[model samples]
Target: MISSLRKDADIIIKKSIDAVLPDEAVKRALKGFKKGTGKVVLVAAGKAAWQMANAAVKEMPDISEGIVVTKYDHVKGNIPGITCCEAGHPVPDENSFSATRKALDLVRPLGEDDTVLFLLSGGGSALFESPLIPGEELQDITKQLLACGADIVEINTIRKRLSGVKGGRFAEVAAPAKVYSIVLSDILGDPLDMIASGPAVPDTSTCQQAQEIAARYNLKLSDEARNLLGKETPKELSNVTSVITGSVRELCTAASNAAKDLGYEPIILTDMLSCEAKDAGSFLASIAISNSRKGDKKLAFIAGGETVVHLKGTGKGGRNQELALSAAIGLNGLSNAAVFSVGSDGTDGPTDAAGGYADGETVSDLKEKGLNINLYLDNNDAYNALKAVDGLIITGPTGTNVNDVSVLLIS
Candidate 1:
C-alpha cells in the first residue's frame, strides 16, 4: 500500500511542477506583446528567468539584446543574443550584483520608442537587486528577515525601500522606454506590488509599514539599512505595462487533476495556505487521520501556498521539507496515509531536494535506525532525516516558481 501511495505521489508531484513550468505561460503572456519601434531588449530575472526568456526568444525571435539573471544552475543553456548569468537566491551575493549591473546597463540608454521585455518571476527580489545600501549590509538585513520568519510580502515591503531597481525604480530607470512586464506570482492573492518586490510596478507598501515590520521582527539592521527603510520607494510609475500569467492556484489545480485520475476523490483545501511550516504539516496530518476513519474511500487533500520557517535551529531545510517531516509525527501508525510537500521551483532552501515526504512507516524506520524524529525536528534537520528514510524529493531546477504544494493522501 505504501509503495502504491509513493507511485501516486510521484505522479502528482511531477504533474504539479510540470504544469507551472513558465514556458507555455510566458508564450501565452507574450501573445499580446506590443514591441516598440526602436530596439527591443529583454531583461529576465528570478528562478524562472532562463525558461521565460528562452520561451520569449522563441516566440518573438527578433529581440535586439537580452540579459537573464537567475539562481545558480537554473540556466539550462545559452540562448542566442541573451547573456545568461547565474546568481544567489533567498540571499543576494556578488554574482547577483554583477548580473543586475549588466541588466541595468542594458536598458539605461533606451528611448521612448524602445521596449524592455522584462520577464519577472519569483526570486527576483534577490536576483534583480541593486542596493541603496552596501551589498553586505543588504544581505545581512535579508538574512535577518528570513531568520525572523518574515512572509514574502513583509520581506518584499522592506526590500522595496532598500533596492535601487525595486519598488518601481526599474521602471523609473527605463523611463522613456516602455517596460512590458510579465510576472509569475509566487505570493498568495497575486499581489502585484509584492511579487519579486515589484521591480516594474508601483509600490503600495509605505515607509510606515516597512518600519513597523522591522519593529515587529526585531530585525537587526545597519544604520544605513534602517535609514533606507524609512525612505520612500517609488509610489507611481507611468512607463510599465504589466500582466500576471500563473500562480499557486494553477499548481494546485494540476495536482487535483492528477490525484483524481488516480481514482482518489481530490479536495482542494485552500490555495492561500500561509502559516508556520510545522503547523501546516500537522494540520494536514490531522485531516489525514480524520479521513482515515471514513472507510475505504480514497482521498487526496491539497493545500497550496508558501509557508515560512522561523529558523529555530542551525540545521538546514526549506519550508516544504520541514512541513513533511513535521507531518510524520501524526502519521506514525496510519497504515494507508502519506503526506508530501514540494516546491514548484524544484529547489527548497539551499538544498538539492525539492521537498520531503512521509508515510505511516516513517516513524518506525527512524526508530529502527536509532534516529529520534524529535531531535531532528528540533534542530530543523529535515533534509538529513528525510534522506535517511528515502523521503527526500529531488527534482533539480524545475524552471518555474508558483510557491509550494502539499498533499495528503489516504488510500
Candidate 2:
C-alpha cells in the first residue's frame, strides 16, 4: 500500500506539471486573442519565456522579431530569429540587468502599427529588470524583502517602485506601440497588475503602498529606494492589453483528475492558500492525520499557492521543501500517509531541485540515522534533511511557473 501510495503521489504531481506547460497554455490563450496585422514583436520573460516565445512564434509565423529573457538553463538549444537570453531569478543579477536592457530596446522604438507580445509569467520581476537605483542597492533591498518573508504582492509593490520597466513602465516607454500581454499567473487570484510586476499593464500599487510594505518588513532601503517609493508607477497605459493564460486552478484540477484515476477521493483544500511555510506543511499533515484516523484510505488533500518563509537561520531550502520537511514530523508514524510539496516551475529557491516529499516513516527513518528533524526545520535546512532521506524531487526547469502545489495523501 505504501509503495502504491508513493506511485500515485508521483502520478498526481506529474499531472499537475503537465497541465501548466507554457507552450500549451500560450497556444490556448492565443486562440482567444485577435492577432493584428501589425509588425509583431515577441518579448517573453520568466521561467517559461522560451517555451511561450517559441509557441507564439509558431502561432504567428509573421512575427518580425523576438527576445526571450528566462532563468539560466531554461532555454533549450535556441529558436531561429529569436534572441534568447538567460538571466537571474528570485534575485536579479548583472546578467538580468543586461538582458532586460536589450528587451526594452526591442520594444521602445516600436511604431503604433507595431505590436509587442509580452509573454509575461512568474519570476519576471527578477528575470527581467532595469533597476531605477544602483544595481547593488536593489540587490540589497531584494535580499531584505525575501528574507523578511513579505508576501509576493508586498515584495512586488516595492519592486515595481524600483524598476524602470515594471509596473506598466515598459508599456509607458513603448508608447504608441500596442502592447498585448499573455500572462501565466504565478500570484493568487490572478491579479493582472501583480503578475510579473505588471510590466505592460497599469500598476495600481502606489509609492505609499510600497513604503508601507517596507515598513512592515522593517527593511532598510537606500535613500533612492526610499524616495522612489513615493513615486507612482505607470497607473494607466492605453497601449497595453492582457490575457491570463494559466494559473494554480489548472494545477489543482489536473491533480484532482489524477487522484480520481488512482481511486483516491481528492479534495482541493484551497488554491488561495497563503501562509508561513512551516504552518502550511504542519496543517496539511494534520489533515492527512485526521483522514487516516477516520480510516479514510485513498484520500488526498491538495493545495496550490506560493508561501513565504521568514528566514531566521542560514538555510538552503525553499518554502516547498520546508513544507514537506515540517510535515515529516507530523506524519512520522502514520504508516499509511504521505505528503509532497513541489514548485510547478520545476525549480524552488536557489536549488536545482523542484521541492521535496516525505512519507509517514520519514521522521523515524531520520532518527534511526541519529538525525533530528526539528533541528533541520528550525534551521530552514529542508534541502539537506530531505536529501538525507532521499525526499528531494528534482525535475529540472519545467519550462513553466504557476506557483506551487502541495499534495497530502493517505491510503
Candidate 3:
C-alpha cells in the first residue's frame, strides 16, 4: 500500500532524528564529566544551544553562571541559571557580535581552578561570533562562504582566522581554567576543529589554507579581514578537552535499524555523503534504480551528510530540498519508488520546510499542472516547486543538528 510505505518511511526518519537529539547526547556526555569544586560556567552556542544548555543544567544544577547564544527564536524559554540570547544565524548579525562579547566576558573572569563547560553544536559558527573586523565585513565573508561550493572545513579555515575567539582562542581566553567541550557534530567525520570553527580546539589549519580557500572561491575580503586571515590563530591549548557526542553515523545507524524493523532491507550507503546536493541526489536515485532492476522489493537506501550548493540563481531552497527535487527528476518513471531528504535540524536554508519528499508520481503530478522540474532545479527554486506539489517536509525545529539525511524507498 502507498500509505503504508509512506508511514514506514516517516517512521524510519523519525527514528534517525530521535537518536541524535542534543539533550540526550549532552546528558550522556555529562556522565564522564567530573564536577569542579570551583566556579562552573556553561557556554552553549549553536542551533541546539537551548537544548544542550538545558540538558547540562539538568545534569549539574550547580552551574554558577552561564550564557546561551542561538539563532533567533531557537531559545524557547529561560533556563533558571543561564542567560539566553538570540542572535543571527547562517550570517552573523550585530546581535551575534554582542552575545559573543558577553560569552567572551563570561570566560575572562574565570579562575584557574574554575571550569567552563562549552556545549558546541552545528550553526555555532554563525550563532557564536567575535569578528576581528566589522560586523558588515564578517557577514559579507560568511555569505560568500555559503554561496560558494567550499566545504565546512574550507569555510571554517577562513572563519577561524577572522574571529577573536575561534580556533582555540576561546580556550585561550579561559586560560588556566579547564574547558570541557561536548560537541554534537553536523559535519562529516566529526572533525572537532571544523565544527563551529573549533572555538575550543586548537587550529590545525594555517593562514595559507585560509588564503588558498579565499583565492579558490574568488572571495573578496576587506583589507582588515585579509590581514587577519594571513595571521595565525591559536595553535595550542592546554586547558581544553573536546568530545564528539553525536554525529551523522548515529543517525544513519538508527535509520538502518528502523527500516529493518519495518520489513525493508536497509542499506546505509554512506555516512560521509557529501558533494553538490543535486549530484548526490542523482547518485542515490541511480542506486535505487539499480536495485529495482533486480526486482527487489522493499528496500531502503540512506545517506547522511551536509551537501553544498553553489548558488548560481537567487532562488530560495536549501541543499536538502534541492537533493530531493533532483532525485524526483531521476526517479520520474520508476514505479513504487519514493525519495526524501531532510535536515536533522528541521530546516532547509531560509525555508520553513525541513526538506522534501517525492514519490514516483511526483513528476507526473507536476507535469499535469504544467510545472517544469528542470526549470525549477536550474533556478534553484526547489522550495517553491516542491510546495506546489505538496512535497515539502515541514518539521519545525527538531532541537538537534546531526546533518542531512537522504532516503530512497523502493518496492
Candidate 4:
C-alpha cells in the first residue's frame, strides 16, 4: 500500500514541476514584447536565469549579446551571444560581483532607445549581487539573516539596501536604456519589489521597514552595512517595463490537479504556508492522520510556500528536508500514510536533494537503524537522517523557481 502511494507521490511531483517550468510562461510573457529600434541586450539572473534566457533568445533571436548569472551548475548549455556565468546562491561571492559588473557595463553603454531585456527570478538577490560594502561583509550579513530565521521579504529588504544592483538600482543603472523585465516570482503574494530585491521594479520597501527587520531579527551588521540600510531605495523607476509570471500559487494548483488525476481527492490547504519547517511538517502529518481515519478513501493534501529554518544546531538541511523529517516523527505508526516536500527549483538548501519523504514506516525503519528523528531535527540534520531511510528526493536542477510544495497522502 505504501509503495503504491509512493509511486503516486512521484507522479504528482513530476507533473507539478513540469507544469511550472518557465519555458512556456516566458514565451507567453514575451509575446507582446517587440524589440526597440536600438540594440537588444539580455541580462538574466537567478536559479531560473539560464532557462529563462534560453527561452528569451529563442523567441527573440535578434538579441545582440547577453549575460546570465545563475546558481553554480544551473547553467546547463550556453546560449549563443550570451555569456553564462555561475555564481553562489543564498549568499553572494566574487563570481556574483564580477558577473554583475559585466551586466552593469553591458547596459551603461546603451542609448535611450536601447532595450535591456532583463530576465529575473528567485535567487537573483544573491546570484546578481554587487555589494556596496565588502564582499565578505555582504556574505556575513546574509549568513546572519539566514541564521536568524528571517523570511525572504525581510532578508531581501536588508539585502536591497546593500546591493548596488538590487532595489531598483539596476533599473537606475540602465538610466536612459529601457529595461524590459520578465520576472518568475518565488516569493509569496508576488511582492514585486521584494522578489529578487526588485532589480527592475520600483521598491515598495522603505528605509524604515529595512531598519525594522534588522531590529526584529537582531541582525549583526557592520557600521557600513547599517548605514546603507538607512539610505532609501528607489521608489520610482520610469525606464522599466515589468511583467511577472509563475508563482507558488500556480505550483499548488498544478499539484492539486496531479493528485486528482491519481484518483485522490485533492485539497489545496494553502498556497501561503509561512512558518517553521518542523511545524509545517507536523501539521501535515496531523492532517494525514485525521483523513486516514475516514477509511479506504485516498486523499492528498497540498501546501505551497517557502518556510524558514532557525539554526539551533549545525544541521545540514534545507527547510523542505527538515519539514519532511519532522513529519516522519509524527507519522511514526500511522498506516498507509506518507508525506513529502520538494522545492520547485530542484535543489533545497546547500544539499543536492530537492527535499525529502516520510511515511508511516519511516520511524520504525530509522529506529531499527539506531537513528532518532528527534536528535536529527535538533541538529537540523534532516539530510543525513532522510538519506538513511532512502527518503532524500534528488531531482538535480529543474530549471525553474517557484517556492516549495509539501504534500500529505493517505491511502
Candidate 5:
C-alpha cells in the first residue's frame, strides 16, 4: 500500500506541474507576435520565473534581451542572454525592490516597434515590489494582511494599489510596446487581474476596492498607500493583452488523468476549494473515509486551490503541511487509505519541506513519539509534527506554481 501510494503521489505531482509548464504557455501566447517584426523583450517574475523565462528563450531564440526575477532558491541553470536575479517571496526585501526597479528601467525604453513578453506566475507580487506607498508601509501592510488570514485574492487586491508597478502598471510603463502576458494562475477561477497582481493585465480593481479590503481586514496602511489608492489607473495601459494558460483546473485535470492511468476511478472534489487549512484537511479526510466505506475497489479524489493559515504560533510550516497534519489527525486508524497535500511550487510556506503525506498508520506513529497534534497545530509547527511521523514530503523546488494540490486514495 505504501509503495502504491508513493507511486500515485509521484504521478499526480509530475502530471500537475506538466500541465502548467511556463514554456508551453509562452509558446502558445507568442503566436500573436509576428516573428522578426519587432524586438522581443522578455520579463518574468515569480517562483517559476526562471523556468518560464528559460522556456521562452528556448521557444523564441530571437528574443533580443530578457529579465527574470525569481525567489532566491528558485534560480535554475544560467541562460546566456537573459539577466536572472533572485529575490525574496511572501515578503519583499531589498533585493526584490532592486529587481523591480531594474525591470522597470529595462521596459521603460520600449517603443511601439518592440514587444514585451511578460511571464507572470505565483509569488511575483513579492519577488518584484515597487511600492507606490513607502516601502516600510507596504511591508507592514503585507505582514498584517497575511496574519489576518486574508485569502490570496484579497491580499493581492490590496497589494495592487500599494505598488508602483503592479495592477497592469508594468504594461503601462512599457506603453506603445505591445504587451503579451502569459500567466500561470495560482488563484481560484484564474482571474487575470489577481495572478501576480496582474502585472501586465487590466486593472479591474479600483483604489476604492483596495481601500475597502484593507479596511475590512483592519489592515493599517501608510498615508502614502492611502494617497496612491485615491489616484486613477493610467489610461494608456488599457491595450495590454493578457492570457491565462495554466490554472488550478489544469492541475486538477492532470491529477485526474494520473489517477485513471493508475487504475483508480478519479473524482475531482473541487477546483475552487478554499478555506482555513485545518478545516479543509478535516473535510477532505471525512470525504475520503466516506468514499472508502462505499466499497469502491479503487478510488482517487483530487482538489486544488490555495488554503489560508491563521498563524497563532511561531512554528515552522506552510498551509499544505498544516492540511496534511490535520488530515492525519482525522484519519487516525482508517485502513487502506492515504492522503497527501503539496504546494505545486514544492515549497510550503516558510518550511523547506514541500508538504506532507500520510496513511492510516500516521496517528499511531505520532502517538508513539508522544506528540500532541493539537498543540503542534496551535503552535504552527505542522512541519515538525509530520517530520516526526515520517510524513513530510520534501521536493525542494518544482519550478512551477499553480497552487496546492491535495489527493486522497482508497484501495
Candidate 6:
C-alpha cells in the first residue's frame, strides 16, 4: 500500500511539472517577438534555474549570453554556453551574494537593441539576494522571518523592500533591454509580483506594508531596510513582459487525473489553499472522515497551496512533512484514508526528504513505536516524526517547482 501511494504521488508530481516546462511556455510567449531585433541574454535564479536556462538555450540557440544561479544540488551537468553557479537556498550565503552581483553585472551592459530573458522560479529570492540593506542586517531579518513561520508571501513582501534588485528593480536595471520573463510560480495564485519578489515585475507593496508584516510576525528589520523601503522606485524602467508558465493548478490537474486513473472520483478542493499547517491538515482530515462516512468506495480530494509552520522546535523537515504528520495525528484511527503532501520541486523546507504521507493507521503505527507526535511537532521535527513511521516521501530533486500539492484519498 505504501509503495502504491508513492507511485501515485510520483506520477502526479511529474505530470504536473511536464505540463509547464519553461521551454514550452517561452516558445508560446515569444511568438510575437520580431525576428533579428536584438541579442538575447538569459538570466535565471532558483531550484529550476538550470532547467529554465536550458529550455531557453534550446529555444534560442543563437542567444549571446546566459547566467543562472541555482541551489547546490539542483545544478545538473553544465551547459557549455551558459554559465551556471550553485548557491544556498532558504537563506542567502556568500555564494548567493556573489552570484547576484554577477547576474547584475551581466545585465548592466545591456542595450536597447538587446532583449533580456529573465527565467524566474522558486528559491530565487534566496538564490539571488542583493541586500540594499546591510548584509548582516538582511541576514538577521531573514533568520527571524524563517524562525517565525512567516508564509512565503509575507517573507517575500519584506524581501522585496530590502533588496536593490528585487521588486522590479532587475527589470529597471536592464532598462531599454526589453525584459521578457518566464516564470515557474511557486506562490499560491501565481502572483507575478510576489514570485521571487518580482525581480522583473513592478512591486506595489510599500515600506509600511513591509513593516506591518514584520510587526505582525514580531520580526524586527534593520534600520537600513527600513530606510531603503521609504524611497520610491524610479519610473523610467517599467518595461517588462512576464508570463507565469507553471503553478499549483498543474498539480491539482495532475492529481485529479491520477485519481481518475486509479478508479476514484477526484475532486479538487481548492488550488489557493493557504493557512497554518496544522489547520490545513485538520481540515483535510475532516474531509476524509466525512467522505468515509458517506460510504464512498473510492474518492480523492486534491489541493494545491503552500502552508506555513511556526518553528517552535528544531525539527528537520519542510511544510509538506509537517502537514502530513498533522493530518495523521488528526485522523488517529480513521480507516482506509491517507494524506500525502509534497513540494513539487521534490524538496520541502530545509530537509532532504521531499515530503510525507499519513494514513488512518499512521498515528497508531507511531504510537506503537513509542513516538510522540505532539512532542516532535512542538520541536518542529516533522522529519523525524514521519520517518519513525516510514512516512517520509523522498524525491531527490524534480528539476521543476510549482508549489505544494496535498492529496487526501479515501477508499
Each prediction's Cα lDDT score? 0.94, 0.88, 0.88, 0.93, 0.83, 0.81
Model 5 Cα lDDT, one tens digit per residue, 1-411: 766776778777777777766777667776765642668888889999998888888888988888899998898789869899998878888888998898889888988878888889899999978987667777778888888899988898888877888887888888878887888888899888889988887778777777788788787766767777777664346547777777888888888998898888998989888999999889878987787677747888888888999989999899999998898877778777788898889889977888888777887888889988888999989999999988888888888898988888887
TM-scores across all candidates?
0.99, 0.98, 0.97, 0.99, 0.95, 0.94
Estimate candidate 5's alpha-carbon lDDT, on a 0 to 1 scale.
Answer: 0.83
What is the Å distance of residue 381 in model 6 from its true position? 0.6
TM-score for predicted model 3 compared with the true structure: 0.97
Writing each residue's lDDT as its tens digit, candidate 2 over 227-339 gives 89989887677887789988999998888888988888889999998999899999988887777877745788989998889898887999999999998878978888998
Residue range 210-275, candidate 4, lDDT tens digits: 999999988888898889989988889999888899999999999999999988888999999999
Off by over 4 Å in 6: 1-7, 17-23, 34-36, 234-236
lDDT over C-alpha atoms for residue 33 of model 5: 54
Candidate 5 vs. true structure, TM-score:
0.95
Q: After superposition, how far is residue 342 of candidate 6 from its true place, in Å?
A: 0.6
Which ranking of candidates, highest TM-score first? 1, 4, 2, 3, 5, 6
Better of 2 and 6 by TM-score: 2
How well does candidate 1 score on lDDT at residue 36? 81
Lowest lDDT 10-residue stretch of candidate 2: 29-38
Off by over 4 Å in 1: none
Local lDDT at 275 for model 3 = 95
Among these predicted structures, which one has the highest lDDT? Answer: 1
Instruction: Please say which candidate is ahead in lDDT: 1 or 2.
Output: 1
Clashing pairs in 4: none
Off by over 4 Å in 2: 35-37
Residue 217 displacement in candidate 5 (angstroms): 1.7
RMSD of each: 0.7, 1.1, 1.2, 0.8, 1.7, 1.9
Candidate 3 local lDDT, 1-411, one digit each (tens): 455656777887788888888887898898888756798999999988899999899889889899999987788898988999998878989999899999999999888889999999999999889888888988988998999888989999999988988888889998888999999999999889989999999889999989999999999987888899889888778998788998999988888888888888888889998899999889878876787667646899989888989888878999999999999877877777788899998889988988988777778889998999999889899998899988888878888989988999887
